[model samples]
Target: MPKTQPTIRDVAAAAGVAVSTVSKYINGTQRFSGSVEAKLKAAIDALGYRSNPLARSMITGKTRTIGLAILDIRNPHFTNIVKGANRVALQHDYTLLLVDTEESQERERPLIEALAQRVDGMIISSRMPDDAVQWLLELSKPVVLFGRSQQFPIASVGTDGHLAASMLARHLLNLGHRRIAYLGFAKSRWNDERRRGIADCLQKAGLQLDVHDAEAPSAIAGERACSAILLGSSQPDAVICYNDLIALGFMKEARELGFRLPQDLSVVGFDNVSYAEYASPALTTVDLQSEKMGELAMTKLIAALNGSHDDEYAMLEPRLVVRESTMRRPDTSQPAGVTEMTPKTAGGRRRTGGQGA
Candidate 1:
């Protein structure tokens, strides 16, 4: 009572050709004369024969699929990365299998292990420790790391977080923000690098950062951090968030708590996510070139799969984009009991009261 699907054999029989000829035509392994090509096409159309990808993969040992594992899909920064990787995958006729690790370290290894079995290669944006990543190399499948670089032999693509954060810290310092705070993501290596950059720059100017950690790199976590940052014993003149989502959350909570943007407080973030430019007053942030990172990672993975081992690590430079959310520190008095710091030059010399251009 059921109709059976046609196979390559059916097309070969209908075209009066050998089964190998049909296979070659279907796989594009050989080009035939125009008349032979026409005949095969006509026979394929008549029989409604479709090649089975699973069967072909069993024979060729290549699934023609790429696995992309990201930390959290809800973040626009990761979403843009996916777009760039998917574009390259499409161009190469490879299917992209996406998986979200949901920021779970425990899930990364098992998820990647399972995914690696069915894909030709993988691109991973993981929070796993470097030692844990070493195990992935044993799988024999090409893997390209996204967003973080390591000393391991695996290919990687990432932006320079330290440089990016250093630039942002210098910007805030130039704006006369002596009391600066950093809203960081907990347990993140990238966050550590950024904090170090900010701290290094501040230390050079004879100032230090007021550090706070968010449970996660999300708007809600950022909002929750407001209590510690704004209502703490000392209030900072400016806050640099780990990413745009956190910055946006902090801004929202700050406004609800009677603080005005760049007036009562100045705020900046990293990642330059789509929401950054569309926030109430727009946000000043660093551009990590997330999309380009994705493209490069995918490209590198593909190259590795093809036996090319050069360019194992690609690091993109970050750019700082200034917008409406940050401004020169207003000449206002500090909160009661909080010390006011005179703006200092990089060499530790105090400067007269004037904002940086």
Candidate 2:
């Protein structure tokens, strides 16, 4: 007789279970009892049954896959969000496909269109404005946004950028950071809110907020942006970064140029990425619950796919993690700029450098 390949039906029969139960367990779509699980495992081992996801998906009318779009995977914060989303996807026996738009809005539409055809749903860290969200809503697949927008109508999970920055600003104000500078990207989606929060807080304290721009969200960009600020005449007593990656970069450059952490300049940052704790002075940052946000986005997306998604937005509050990076502003005001790094350009500007609804 010819050799026969073991099928899902064969395993089901061996385990005295329904074929659907066997299939569901194999696909990780649902959990099972211990006894049933043991039987299923034994049956699969004995029969050498192999699952064909494609065939199973075809019959069930589900691809069992999700697509995730991020502005830039290079950012450590986004990397942690990916980690969080992946955990939820695995728990549900689904696969995740990740793509980056390189922080370009032009690249987003094409990525979304291409990914829409391959997956049941999507989660995005969208960087565009209202029109973009409207366009995404019209797509075939369900969507969950990872950040905020005044115009977002679709479901989103986000930490309150404005509130988070406000909290940091208040903390700094309490610590007496009058000459504080903001370090961040100019084109970021959350830039307006983040700036508003800090600016408002500063205004309340009768101080003007100094804004410095970074062209990109990378560490190297941070180093370049901070270089000008560190060398400029109007050096701030403290600097608040857009995110931990940029903050870490600024810290590295500052230390290299002989600026003592929290002594010469107090520094604060957003998005408490893993490296924040391990940093030389241990970064003081906002914990945005990045992984939890990712998990929530994925969970909501799955629910939406199953016709159980709520239209309400899920907002997460960021917690401040005070480490060695931030301290009381030094008694001597007008902290000295690092003259040894480089000379500033003739221009007065920096030379080199949220949630869905």
Candidate 3:
């Protein structure tokens, strides 16, 4: 007769525990006492027991894996989020497959469809449309949103973009900045969420939204948009950027225009990325808790897999990080490139006030 493979049942028998106890331990469903946990581990090792999670999932109509759909992998903010999600997923023995839509929602749909076939669930961190999310819901698979929340019953885990934007705008407004411009790539749906946040603040204060366009979500794009704003007839006293890259780009261009940082134009950036602090003037930004958002999404996804949570959403708070990049409207200011700046610090390391510098 062929030898039988050591299964979870054998491990449970050896450990003197119910099969359900072993299952809970393996799937991260419930915690066990220290001694019991140790004995269970020993029993599994002694019996050479191995869990075929994939096979078991197959039997149960699950894949035991989750898919992550994101936009612009090059952005540091997104990168941090991926790291956080990966970390949390590993703890629960879950695997993550990432998909970058190249900032294109059209590509997002097909990619999500392809991935949904292989993974048990998905987390979308892109500019996906409501209709697309509804479509995913109809597919009968667990889906979660990373940044934006859907109107339907799918899960959402992210920072409060609107509140963050309002905080940034309010900071500038409090600094006596009357002419403020918001620069971003508004073509994408995700950007719209951020825009609405800033718009809410501006409207509340009886101020109009001065919007500008960017080529992309990079430093180069930020430079172009900021340059345009500088050349425009109505020069803004401050500019609220979509992200750190755009804000850095604007600062670079502002310098070329013989403008001094914070003296002539105070700039505020979102997503408090690493480079925010190392720039010539340092950058003031909103900390979106990207990593925490990722961690939360992973936790939620894992919980869903273990039947812990139904379809619930999680939202994290965003805090503002004030740094050297912004200060009271400069009393004495000049156009960009009027004065040369000193070389950056050693190792070219930018100071991270604490989190995203």
Clashing pairs in 3: 257-336, 258-335, 258-336, 258-337, 258-338, 259-335, 259-336, 277-357
Taking all chains together, the TM-score of candidate 2 against the true structure is 0.81
Of the two candidates 1 and 3, the one with more favorable lDDT, higher being better, is 1
Residue-level lDDT of model 1, residues 1-357, one tens digit each, is: 899999888898899999999888887668999999999999999888888999878767888899999999999999999999999989988999999999898888999999999899999998876666788789888888865545578888998888888878877776778899999996776888999989987887788889999999999998999978999988998999999999999999999999989887889999889878889878988888888888888899888878998545688988777777888876733333223333333232212221211
Order of candidates by TM-score, top first?
A: 1, 2, 3
Instruction: Estimate the overall C-alpha local distance difference test score of candidate 3.
Output: 0.77
- Please provide, for model 2 over 197-311, each residue's C-alpha lDDT reduced to its tens digit, 9 standing for 90 to 100: 8888777767888899887777887788877998898999889998887888898999888999988888888888887788888887778898999999999999998898576
Point out the worst 10-residue segment of candidate 1 by lDDT. 348-357
Reference-based lDDT, residue 47, model 2 = 89
TM-score for all models, in order of appearance: 0.86, 0.81, 0.77
Better of 1 and 2 by lDDT: 1
lDDT of each: 0.84, 0.81, 0.77
Error of 2 at 136 (Å): 1.1
Clashing residue pairs, backbone N/CA/C < 3 A, model 1: none
In candidate 2, how many Å is residue 352 off?
A: 34
Ranking by lDDT: 1, 2, 3
